[model samples]
Target: MSAPDERETLATSLYAHVLALRAAAPDAPLPPGGLPLPRGARPPRDGAPGPRAREAWPAVTTLVRSALADADPVRAALALERELSAAGIRDRHVYAAVAALPPPEEARDRARALARALTRTGTTVTAVAAGLGLLVPLGEPEDVPYLRALGLLEGLGDRAARALAPLDRKAAAVAWLVRERSDALRPLVDALVRGDEQAARALLTGLSTTPRDLGRRQARYIAEAVGLTALLRDGPGLLVPAFGLLARMSEGPEAEIRAYDEALTLYETVADRARELPPLLGHRARLVTLVQELDSGDARLLPWPPGRRRAVLTALLTAVGEPENLSDPAASADWRRAEWVHRTARHLAAVTTAVEAGGRRAGAAGVPPTSRLRIEVAVGDLGEPTGVETRLLVDGRPLVPSVFGSGVGEPPETVLLNGALRAGPQPTEVRLAEAICTEGCCGALYVTVRRDGPHVVWDGWRRPGAPPGLPQAPAYRFDADAYDREVSRAERDLGWAWPARRTAWLIAEGLRERPGILARWGLRRGWISTDFHRPDVTVITFLGPPLRPDGTPDAEAATRQFLRHLPDDGRPPRERAAEALRRLAEEDPRRHPEPGE
Candidate 1:
């Protein structure tokens, strides 16, 4: 193919993905002409220049190549830099150029330069957002200082949010956090400041996947920020982050203090904001007392009820037995705290039971509940996709997004069923050419859905089972109701078992084995508060004895196994505990491959 034709071919291929995104997420704000969907929102509306148009495809390609093409690449690079500065990053053409530029020595150099220049120059929100798209994926740790500045900005205000709405600031922040892997608080704070659509999704991905390790105080600070985001929204923010904070604060010793502080702050902010809003989001009179009780460190009536308040306290107690009483004797103090927890667990369990019953009735009502939805696509073997995903939920249906354009064949490992990428309208058919991983391998996840009168039947989307994991994605089946059903199951299951080590292991096993049914429970906000392996996995010292093939634990064997996973801290365990742990960790396969064998 000629150079223009080759560029056209690639652009055409990219355009197809864009169209698929448009078709799938009809509700998104489509942009004008052939521009890359800014932050995965807005492609041109119908009757506008579609991607197939001779004029449209080539223009984007021309813009991309012009910025990179060169006989002496550096000269062209300098010229592009001048042009970018002269025209200003705010120019619409800048975004098209930035989003489309093919990676090359010159492109990489230019992107870094541009990110730095744009950051220093203070571009418009759209320009800054578009600049982030280009830089986050390709920019290095050095370029972080500039991007970090953008991430640190507070008070974007409603107007700025609306202005950047087309750019999908939420997704951009998340994409930056995920791809850049910057540990700086700026990024998390930025995402929260903008009130990310699915704040928890971005926050969690960054927290878990980023190479950077964050401290408990910083984590607590983030917890406060997430709660602050919710408070700012008053009536409705992404509830996940707010709830996710409860989970975070519930973890670690003295973490409850952080949780209580965040909740109190949130409660105060919410009370103030609610007064400003049209009407309160649902009465939380009991919630006030819950916060007060926690703040007071009083173990009195425990006035919290069946909602957020109960969950928060349950998670806190579950993390660290109970608050200490300064008046109590030092040695016997542990016993008293344990006794308090024993009592609290019963009350919390009762509350959870009540909530579960109510949730079941609500869920059993059968109609699919109306709510925002986001789609996350996983790539690489990182257990999640890079920001190589987008949310284009049109009328509650996720489209295979254009964000996957750059990752067409990466063999999407998993498509996270949540995260509101941007606000848009809905369309009928969900036409996607994507990959899906199955059974720890990969295959294609191509599907074309159209309505069959009253409902969408995947009869149009009969994707076969895919090979699992990376490289080649398998065709996997999807049930839209899976999220709801899984949550219901988790609630019932969690309620059945108290906060025991066994409960955590079962939850993990449930996720790994029956992912379709219970996977979300492990990762989603309302589910497990701590990351999958936290206190529980460490509680491996707590892992019970050997199990029968039927999977029932053998108490005798469990004690032995517990000792095995447990590392000997400087201090020693009880003699029996030490023996069990040592035996479990050091069991000789030659002597014990099969106890009776």
Candidate 2:
């Protein structure tokens, strides 16, 4: 078999092994499935009892089932000791034994009662801890106090106790613990962050011994931390696993809000530095869904007024910019680049959808609108030699004011919401919003949909814009219309190859524009197209639209993963491409195998 095929086979096998290990010891910073590692390396177990734990499952399961049912506490204790001893387990690992046994299939109320009893006694046995954790997935409401009580039981000190005091919510407490316990938990987070898969097993096993929900929350937070860490990590291998956990945990409003904060942090961290990593793209894709969720009115922010939250949300979204769709000149300020046109256009679509829904609500209000109820973006985030300016007006009033800025301008969260969303509601106008604020910074996206149902929808209120505002940013500005026109022309001219041509432009235009030789070389190779089946390595990246309407990689998508390309070179594909380009820069064009450059 070819060397590439061998690498693919090895990676696939290693991935399977790592998955099994992750299942067995979830709290460890075990490697995700896609990490490319050297030969014969095993993921560290952090003193985990692999074979011993495996052997103890059946025996421990029987003991736990009996112990859970036995009226005699002494008999249950003895049964646990005898079975655990026979299976080569010890005191520290008693949690693993109880964890191995599934939560009872029925009698959920009884299970909760049993869990509460275990908590009251503050049992040091690992099984009790394991029992406490299983309650969450087994239909327990996951109380903050219970988690705090468990932490105290496990010798979790004053910090953990103090952190859990204010919040009754599970996710909020978890987020806090992620910050406070960075010393103890940072290892697993770091391991996943580096894709090292080292002695994370012990950390993971420690979590697993009786802590499913917190363990899962740790995993989710680890993914978030890793994604933020990816901004400087040189590659995006950690992103897929991180975003996957985020997507899974984001089932409700509180969870979604926490996740949105994480996503925004991730984007703000890496928006300018590393744009093409798969995980970064994945994170962006997730942001679209998250914003959509906030706009959908599933979670009502009862405390905030209508236009207030939506205005903030719109600012954040527009200022943050989309992953695949940034205009040529600018990104956001926190991202160190600002974009307005396409960004505002995106918000326009979201608000228009909400407006249509609001119009339905208007029908209930006995006031029907004559308009077709679609939004029109009269002016986009336009960039020019003179200055940067853009707008999103609703029914002749501003959804957001003209956005144009450069270098470091005003606070971005304020810019997108400057003097907008204040118009009187049309017969069909309905706006829904959720405001998020922290450390004196606040923002949110607003959708104009009818308050059709008695849900927590609000009307766009007349409010003055907040300031400490940003001026026009021209250095990072591009004439978005011109850029789009060029892309459209390429589509008209080349059809399927437009993606390739567009990629070539990115490689040539964007990369070369960087102040480095590596960029120029890589772009040349992209235009040359002499190495489609390049051996050893080829960097796989994507450009243009990410998903089809059906939510698959669009026709233009050609990522290494989507294209069935193999990983042969030990280095990352991006690194490999850079090396290849460096080599090509030295080679003579006359010696080329085949070339169009």
Candidate 3:
């Protein structure tokens, strides 16, 4: 046979011996199957065991089983001991099985005798006997210390606690004594914060039973020491009580408010806080939500107390008005200005109901509407050439005389009006109004007109070099007519089926090119697209109408000139020729002429 085949045969023989030994010791369970026997089980291939020794395995199994079945474990153990001594069964397979039997009362005497014999014989049988001796329960903590020192905790598990209960109880008592002696139990505190959940829970439960002030302080220290502030911010649920403890520890109104604000900054779920807090403090929850809305440019202001409302509005206007605040010129242009104004107006509208309620309350004592009314106007933009005009109209006629100015290296004009006769504040009895604008010419205008008390004010503002001529009437009247004409031309240029769709498409497209346009219209991007369909394609559809009333393009008609090539295939010709165009416009009236044409 080849050398490889010889090795395989020897390994097989060793495995069979291990199995035979396992069968002999019926009381002891075998090790997990499929393990190869140790080196001692096989001799050198050149000096293989004789056939007679191989055949002796079955008789060995029978003898070992008979010896273990003896009534006294001492007798059984001694019998196996004698077999080990006489037969020289050194394989772990034989020794492990003998070790597994429960030790008899005289097991110690028998084990010592075997140990001495094995020692004299210079073999490992004594080591195996000692290991079996240790397995007998001695009920001593000293033995456990050896296990513990070796970090064999995994092997002991709950067994260690039961076996050394007195030692464990003593350890707990000592820990408590340490905590009592030192005010700063740094080790305990560190363990609580970084220990396993069970250990931390046990420590925290003990700590909580301490005096209230000390407990609260300790909890706060642990919370801070663990770097839990950011974690609390992300998940306030875990630290809700911790925040309450912090509040309890804080002193004075400012300190309390600072703590509350810090905690509030960590969580957006203020509704729960609102529900939990007293009514007066519940308002702060709403305020937080309102402030978030404002910061995000929601254009939905809260109708709070005048003082609060004024504070918020003032802050917003100041932010927009500051030269440094206007970050980009393109963002501060006319389009952005219109958006900012519109958003401000909507926000103002949301708060109008509350303002009106407050006004009624002020008028409770029969105060007449004739009280002096004041209107304040503030304009903000880049430091470029910009101007404003104020016009006050009363009873449908001009009230404040129209005034405009330009900046030619001079400061932009700021005007304050009183009851003086610059076209006397049109009497309040007839209906007062106001309009403001950019420049004196008032040819190009951004105007705001409002009726304040019994007088009227009309105002407009423009960039420095706006058109010079001011029409005799309000600019909007003329602009309205011009606007209509442009709309008509745009509709005709783009073959729109209805003016509304055309308008919607135009607005949607304009907003897409300039997102700020939606803010000016007091609409959201979602609302714009929701109200219109295929806005881009619709723009193309309207740019050139394809349908004729009779469902045929009037090729010979002058009025329908723009409809000649309404549906162009969106491709270059070389790749697909005119085939794509022909296919796309097969049913299109503009592409298909009358049958006889």
TM-score per candidate: 0.26, 0.32, 0.17
What is the per-residue lDDT of model 1 for residues 524-568, given as tens digits with 9 covering 90 to 100?
Answer: 111321122232122331222445566454545523322223232
Q: Worst ten-residue run, lDDT, model 3?
A: 405-414
Task: List runs of model 2 lying over 4 Å from the truth.
Answer: 1-55, 89-125, 137-147, 152-180, 183-336, 340-597
Q: Would you give me the overall lDDT of model 2?
A: 0.35
TM-score, predicted candidate 1 vs. hidden true structure:
0.26
Local accuracy by lDDT, each model: 0.35, 0.35, 0.31
Runs in model 1 lying further than 4 Å from the true structure: 1-60, 70-97, 100-102, 105-107, 114-131, 149-244, 247-597
Q: Which scores greater on TM-score, model 2 or model 3?
A: 2
lDDT of 3 by residue, 1-597 (tens): 788865555433222433444456533422222123333333233544332434434444454455435555445544554554455433333433433444457555444444232222212232223232333333244443322211111112122222233343322222222222244343444343233434433443343212233442333344443333454445434333433334332311111222222333322333224234333221222232233233221111222343543455333333222122224535633333343343434333333333445544322221111122212121211111121222222222222222221111111111222222122323222112222232343323233333344333434333333445534334222232322332232223221122323333344344456644323322234321111222112221212233457665444544322221212133332223224223323434234443333
Candidate 2, position 377, lDDT: 15
lDDT assessment of candidate 1: 0.35
Q: How many backbone clashes does candidate 2 have?
A: 35
Superposition error at 577 for model 3 (Å): 33
Q: Locate the minimum summed-lDDT window of 10 residues in model 2.
A: 404-413
Using lDDT as the yardstick, the better of models 2 and 3 is 2
Q: Candidate 3: misplaced stretches above 4 Å?
A: 1-338, 341-502, 505-597
lDDT of 2 by residue, 1-597 (tens): 789865554344322433444456655432222222323222234676544555655655666666678655445544544444444454334454554446656745555555455433322333344344434444233454444333422122222323333343333333334343444565654353334544433344343211223443454444443333443354434443433343334322224333333444443333333333343433443344334333422222223354544543454344335544343323432121123333433544545444647644322221222232212212111121111112222232222322211111112112222222222233233122222222123332333322232222233432223233533312111233332332232223221121222233233333345524432222222222112333222232322223445544355654221111224434443454454435435642223222221
How many Å off is the CA of 256 in candidate 1? Answer: 20
